[model samples]
Target: MEESPAAARWRVPPAQTALKCAAAAVFAVLAALSDEPGGLLLAAVATLGSGGLALRDLLAPVRVAADPGAVTVVTGFAGHRTLTWPEVLDVGTDERRRFLSTTRLLEIRTDDDLYLFSAFDLGADVREVADELDRLRAGGPRS
Candidate 1:
């Protein structure tokens, strides 16, 4: 089913989610086959970490969603936090340059905290998402 025309949502893409699950599966196999104690411990840790992340992503697929009234985001471990338009102080993009690469992130600022999301987290370009958020915050049309 399609989302309502009044709201827009974004999530970790299905392919990326599948890749995370696959990595977890590989880690599980490695954990099972590891004979050395150190190797087994390492693999077990990897399995649990990746598996937990995959489960979280699967459970809360929509990382970010916004409507005319409020913006909702998936927070820690499948939890969700909703901020009304009034609570949202700013919607913008941040860029960090490291070595040869630059990372762009969508940032939502509030009185209490600043929430940042990567493209992987939003399943869309950070700039586009920020622009959409700005439009929504301004009571513009949803596109």
Candidate 2:
């Protein structure tokens, strides 16, 4: 038997989307019930805009899915970017230490540009993701 080429598919938690939708609904209802037009309008706009962004995230999440053919990058609403093994030039990590915490990001460099993927958004360690991507890019096993 042979394994399918489809490697991994990363997506944001659905709870995040649900929370955003709930917030939007709450704000809209509050605005409708409020007597103050200015505050109502402000609340309505903020909530709706936030909801739209969240919905977009749900629809098209930031994911890096690699297969035998190519690696696909979906950056919520930004569209898809595909890179073949040869096109995946390099994979690295970025770390930033703040006042009390640190942040890590996975960086992918190609022939023409560089892309950054956040571990937080992927719900995985940046190093792990980078390693897997590097392996796939090098024509190694998907596992």
Candidate 3:
């Protein structure tokens, strides 16, 4: 049987989500076991923040999916955004450098605004995603 196009959604790897939850659990346990006076407060705060983020990421996740007619982006806390081929003006890659580390990002430009999607969420190479999006916008094969 052939899978539906909507079933081909892309999302952050489950391993990453598991890692975040494990890290948060470790911090939470450390916070509970901390004995230092001032250090205990800081550790507890960090545990709470980390735990919250872990829960959010696990629940919402980050995803990008494409159908024949449109693309969908779900950036966890950022909510969902969709754009049809006609709405897309251009699709390309953008790079950011900080110190010795560099990161590349996928960008989509529409008539009204430009949107950026992270490769982490797409679970694929940023360049590949950008190229595929460009092809899709040009009315090429969805794959």
| lDDT against the true structure, each candidate | 0.88, 0.74, 0.70
lDDT of 2 by residue, 7-76 (tens): 7655555677677788888888887887898988888897888778677777666567776678877743
Ranking by lDDT: 1, 2, 3
Model 3 clash pairs are none
Residue pairs in candidate 1 whose N, alpha carbon or C atoms collide under 3 angstroms: none
Query: Model 1: runs farther than 4 Å from truth?
Result: 1-3
lDDT, candidate 1, 34-132, per-residue tens? 999999999999999989989988999898898889999877789999999999999999999999999999999999989889999887899999988
lDDT computed for candidate 2:
0.74
**Any idea how many clashes model 1 has?**
0
lDDT of 3 at 32: 80
TM-score for all models, in order of appearance: 0.95, 0.78, 0.78
For candidate 3, give the lDDT. 0.70
Q: What lDDT does candidate 1 reach at residue 71?
A: 94
